[model samples]
Target chain A: MNDAPVTAPPRAAALALGDDALVLSHRLGEWAGHAPVLEEEVALANIALDLLGQARILLSLVGDEDELAYLREERAFRNLQLVEQPNGDFAQTIARQLYFSTYQLFLYRQLAAGDSAFTGLAAKAVKEVAYHQDHAAHWTLRLGDGTAESHERMARACGALWRYTGEMFEPVEGLEVDWRALEDSWRESVAGVLERATLTLPDGPRSGAWRAGAGRQGLHTEPFGPMLAEMQHLHRSHPGASW
Target chain B: MSSSTDWPLWEVFVRSRRGLSHTHAGSLHAPDAEMALRNARDLYTRRNEGVSIWVVPSSAITASSPDEKDPFFASAADKPYRHPTFYEIPEGVKHL
Candidate 1:
């Protein structure tokens, strides 16, 4: 019997992660035609494009792109809870972006430097993320120090999103991707930047809890159902539709 | 400096990744030179197009008035003989 090496255990897991990115990118694109300001709209669109591009690479590396995106059920998504949250308002959207991009920036930086099969992907992805971080950091400074209402809104948005922060760093089973060495370093780096911007790093939650343990196991938050239906409708309804 | 009541608009120029010359990117609102530069970095360099950026307050710019259009430099257009063209091809001009 001849043998080719079996696929890595993490393949499905990583594809799930990639799907999270792709879905979130699509959601962010909804803001493109309707952001509060023209400049802000362009910024969000750019960030969305970057993430979508990253998702494509990550998905292709793992398996078939369409299947990775469409075949998966709502429960299979592994995005942090923050990303799946709806864009409630301008402040809320920016706050979600800032939180996710901050975390993604850290995650990508570590992966770029680490020993991983996805080193090439991570390296290029990290280059794009530098801009994402800058975008978020800039807005954080402006909104935090802006007019009184803006300041209050930012604080509230951060407070709401902070609870989702833990999901970013929380480990998932069989994903087995490790940034253990860079964990503290990443945290400190983001903390310093936030401090310089004069924004507080929002705490996780008052419930003293995180929605964990199920992301990788095909379990998801309540919002995932509608997001999936919208995302996968065409592909599911008309199988084999293509360019 | 104290008399300045509003934020001075800054024009950003970015030199993407060791590029020789900086190109005008866009503008951002900021109070001073240092803040403008930082904002420029945040807005322009975030995409990593730039290894460096320059921000100059829009007010500090001294530009020739478009209203004085014909009088200012219109004289140069008629002076073609003021060029080196008149003497350049005389005899053997080595490597000219």
Candidate 2:
């Protein structure tokens, strides 16, 4: 590791954000051959590629991208629990996408408006995340209102994913975005999408002991370890080999 | 959960750039118009191939049958005088 004179705070922020993108990109990529339809396969892959691009940029700011992605232990990752969760059914995946993409769009928008280390990347990434948010919102609306079975699955997924969302708005030391405003905007937009979809806002607790995440402190949930092993397998198997 | 077979087929059209007409791309299945547009974006524009997309239900389109090709197009084919290519333009003329 190159121990530079840069302060600890920005490095930590970059790792947190970068890991979120990397983990979620991997999760999305897992759907490459398995999405419910051909169109969905293309859609999910594009979204995965976009997130991977963002992750590479963000991780490069902190350290070697390959090492950060493939060599780190599970405990070393700082991704949100929401991103690391397995792709359950399609509805669950959409619920996760809706929640995280909404938060990411607001966060990037806030960062882009200010002069920070993140400003340039945030400005560029905000547009892509806007599309991602729109995609998730569209699917949520479709699945929520299409049929009784779809509505039940969608509603259940929304409730299951709700517990992991509070961690997104928690303050990071170096990032300058206002956490409270971000949380409020995220809630308002998500609620609006859910209402328009004919789905109710999840009644699950967001910030109390019942909450489901501690990822900001490098703590993750149960699913991350196996996922990390799979993601790192090729890179780890062939040390320094490049195709 | 609707089966994949239940989704309706939509024909995709793409405008590759500004000032261009949307051309037929391909087809994909979607539950509704909104999803159809999004599916077209992902399927047709993944390589920066399009600037805009239009999705129409395949059932909504009316097309000429290939079996009627000679009967349907023979009338127009014989009207060779309608072709601007046959017009003689003076060498001094610029665009004509």
Candidate 3:
């Protein structure tokens, strides 16, 4: 093994974002065979795969994909709680997607403008995030207006998720400017969409402020451990093996 | 506006970039025109495949039935002059 000490922290930061994508994608994939509407089931699955693909590219960029994806312990994972929180119901899933994808749209747009070393990757990602945002926005409008029951559930989902959304913009220590501006822009955009969808943005302890940190510092929620165990079981059980 | 009618079916067309013709993409369901356009963008243009999109309710499309294919198209086949082969170019024709 090469013993060179890695200096710059941005590489690791990239992995933090990548880890969020991987974990959230795993949750999103759970809806593949199980969305309320058949069409939506397909749509969610496709979007999940898109996120997973992004995760793969991102994780691989930071370190070995296998190590980043499968070898890490739970606490070692850096995914935000927003991505790790359990997906509740259809409303909850839509809420999560709306929250995450909207943020992703802003992040990608800024990254495309920024001179990230991964310019090509950021360029490709912008397209996917734009569509993901559209998907989430459509769901937000539908569930918010569909029926009294749906509206109530969606509202609850937004309130529950709104708090967790804070961590998405929590800047990496010493890398604050990199993420802070994007976070502010994302909020403005999300607010507009929420207004149009008739959804209320929550104001509470969990609203766009850090309930926890060190997802950037490589600390993760409780869910990360079990998630990694499952994701890595097959690969770790038989290392150096061909598919 | 029958409540019994199913959600509107939208016909999708995507123009991948400027100066390109909008080509048929596929179809989806949405509650309104705006949502229809958004759905088409999400489903068909997720990969930056299109810079522009169009969505028309499938009900609005009036397609000729397959049962009338022969009767509808038979006249065209007999119009040999429509092919432009009947027109002879002069010896000096530059682009004939």
Candidate 4:
């Protein structure tokens, strides 16, 4: 689109980050009307709105936000596999939020500290992501230490999502971040939260034949297709539509 | 979805800005005071509606009974001196 903001190199990084926000926003929005409590429903929706705002800004840097969001094929999306994973259960959703938001907070903090194109957005977004990380961490602590059932569910969710996390540390073109330090900080922060929550960090391989990491390279997992279909359905049904 | 009935109800108080007394915002169910504070932030202050928040367990409050409305409060209605309505002589004062 003519209104696309950045050029090719930064475009990759923007799309990668934007897609993560957009996809995760959609997944979190799925909690509407179904969260365990009214308070939780509001909390999740508020967080989703914040992510949606960030997604809009990030995606706009690449191209027309609507076209990029609604017209992209499933394989074209560059979101992390962890974000595209289904919202299995409440504890599972919290686990996903904990992992992703912690990474996002660290990534944005690093980006904000640099002189990159992402600095402005990252500066503002870091505050929002801090709240998101806190929300996820608090929930993790409560659920992991609450009842036996909750603890088991939280543990299972954490284990199931562990393999997808390594993809987050991979370097993106045009972003000036120390990937190793980012990964180390992310691991330390997440491990601390998990420990305080009384949950163990899953010791599975994060990147290997059995694990996932290709989403940034325009590859996605099985659930991403259906998610994109549902997300894009409305815009595709009515071309050039606006409300 | 887990049952929220097991969680205790908390009364939320929010101070809209500095120097203002915290007023009752609303209530929500949460497992503990910490979660209740967060829930209060989401429920009542998401739109910059507060500068501070306080969450108290609903069970801790001893509320006056509606059935004793006259005995508990109506006796003060006949006393006119208790009302601050006689101090409107100044022009610039507000929120008095």
Candidate 5:
């Protein structure tokens, strides 16, 4: 007599995706009231909202979204190391966006085409991530080719974030995206953008001890602890209180 | 044109639906037309408020000054015949 869908929702996959969205959303939200320009303030906030929406959906599939987001320990988060990196500068933020959004769009496209628990979310999110990728790409090009200082900053941002790009292609459970193909596509697309932006690619291997990221395994960076404390403080302080 | 950033101001218009005219949403700063359009999308359409957006450089637009309001808009203000209300509705005609 039980008629619920037989597929148990994949907890780990949901946690990973949810954590990625939540972490990146918070990072982007950090730009509120601080973006270099008014238009960019709106742009970054919109992107943050989009990521927050995705995080809410994905997190709810695994557990109480508010609790999961607000109560998780530093090491308990399953986001990629790339997203948890601080928003060092405008150029750095754009570099992170360019890498992450490209991978997200590619992965979401595959998820949207498949039969899975994530299909509906992926279908909706793919369109949003497409715009995110375009926004990042647009900024990357502008910064890379704009002026000497801007170009230098853009180049440094790209190189600094290059290490974290490898983890994006790591396969998650319950999703059927071809990781290798997605990685290849991501590389080609990013390489094309960088070429047009007149920036050089990083020169080191992305998977060795120096470049590998373990945020997928719940390992985060030094900055993550403080960022999480800041994000979760209000919720932890006002438990069960409704806005 | 007045600031150190040198970012130009662009006016934003958003069309909420098909067959409807694009209405003025607001304005924002951008370095160029491409960024202006993207800024318009993010700023004006974040709430699903638009399907299409149009951006125009504020400097490119010419308008009758508010000081000329009497001469520019006064004629239309008193023209009652310009509205369809001047025509009588035939017997059972509705919606007109």
Candidate 6:
């Protein structure tokens, strides 16, 4: 038995991944009472719970999970801008899930295969993320092909969020991932799903000036501020109070 | 919400473990067979309560009329011989 103390996971990578899970979990939690149907509400809540569990595990690796999650300023969060985007509509939320879950599944699969601090967590999380990806893909297909209104909404949502996807390929300081390969696989996977759903890939610039990125650099979009305020409200109002 | 009313209802069955037959768990609404199965998973199996699931359109199941329950189920009520109550005790055969 190796008795050496385990070193802490790289802070930057943990924060980025943890923040992504935490923020997205909160957004999904927002759908609790508003989902279109009872079954869908339960499904979304289950996915949210899974993500919250993952966020707790990842955040705990860095520092006090509550402090890092509840006390962080908007600019201090390292999550990708894709997750912080508002849940515009059911279609929009599904579109965001399709994009982020695909990226997360692939990233976690890579991490699980390698020797890293994230290996154990990634191994477990990959299974949950796979289901998340499947759920999103199914919704994407149904909404994209169901009816004129649904298809239009789905298309609009996919296009609206296309710009933020490029940031997922940006290399963080600590994670040893092949960004190019990850991005390529992500494009192929997403394109296949969209094609099958009868929706064309959005024709827009994914990166460069005027496109979103830099969330990993502790910079965030406008909506993140309000979201942070809401997430931190109960904790911030009564410090260290527990039920 | 209005659109969900247009969706079909499905009956969910869950098999708690291997070698056991599926038991009717409950019902839920979904757009199709695929979504119904996924929804059933979230509803019935999230607590580790099931190892397998089957979702059938509520329309597909032809349930006996509750109004005719007496006539439909009356045949077996007076037949004690139809049950295997005479079997000897088997210590390890729990489900039987």
- Count clashing residue pairs per candidate: 2, 0, 1, 0, 0, 0
lDDT per residue for candidate 2 within B1-81, as digits (tens), equals 456688999999999999999999999999899999998988889789998899999999999999999889987977878
* Model 2 regions more than 4 Å off: A1-9, B90-95
Top model number, DockQ:
4
Which residue runs of candidate 6 sit more than 4 Å off their true CA positions?
Answer: A1-5, B86-96
Worst 10-residue lDDT window for candidate 5 chain B reads B1-10
B1-96 per-residue lDDT for model 4 (tens digits) = 467898899999999989999999988899899999988988899889999999999999999999999999999989987778845559887876
TM-score of each: 0.78, 0.94, 0.79, 0.93, 0.91, 0.94
What DockQ results do all the predictions give, each relative to the true complex? 0.15, 0.66, 0.20, 0.73, 0.49, 0.65
- DockQ measured for candidate 1: 0.15
Q: Candidates' lDDT values, in order? A: 0.70, 0.91, 0.75, 0.91, 0.90, 0.92
For model 5, residues A104-214, the per-residue Cα lDDT tens digits are 999999988987888888999999999999999999999999898999999999999898898888888777889999999999999999989999777767977788689
Compose the digit string of candidate 1's lDDT tens values, residues A1-243: 125453453676466558657867987888877776444566677778888888887788777888878887776666666677788777777777776776677677766675555555677888777777776766667677777777788779877766666656667544444656445655675576567656677655524545333454566667768877888899999998987
CAPRI rating of model 2: medium
Deviation of model 4 at B61, angstroms: 1.0
TM-score for chain A as predicted in candidate 1: 0.85
Q: Which TM-score values does chain B get in all models?
A: 0.64, 0.86, 0.78, 0.83, 0.79, 0.78
Pick out the ten consecutive residues of candidate 4 chain A with the lowest summed lDDT.
A1-10
What candidate 3 keeps of the native contacts, as a fraction, is 0.10
Per-residue alpha-carbon lDDT of model 1 for B1-96, expressed as tens digits?
Answer: 112236667889998867479999998766557557765665787656887888887877899999888899897899888888755586866876
What is the interface RMSD, in angstroms, for predicted model 2? 1.3
Model 4 lDDT vs. the true structure?
Answer: 0.91
In angstroms, the error of model 5 at B63 is 1.0
Q: Model 6: how far is A148 from its true place, Å?
A: 1.0
Deviation of model 6 at A177, angstroms: 0.9
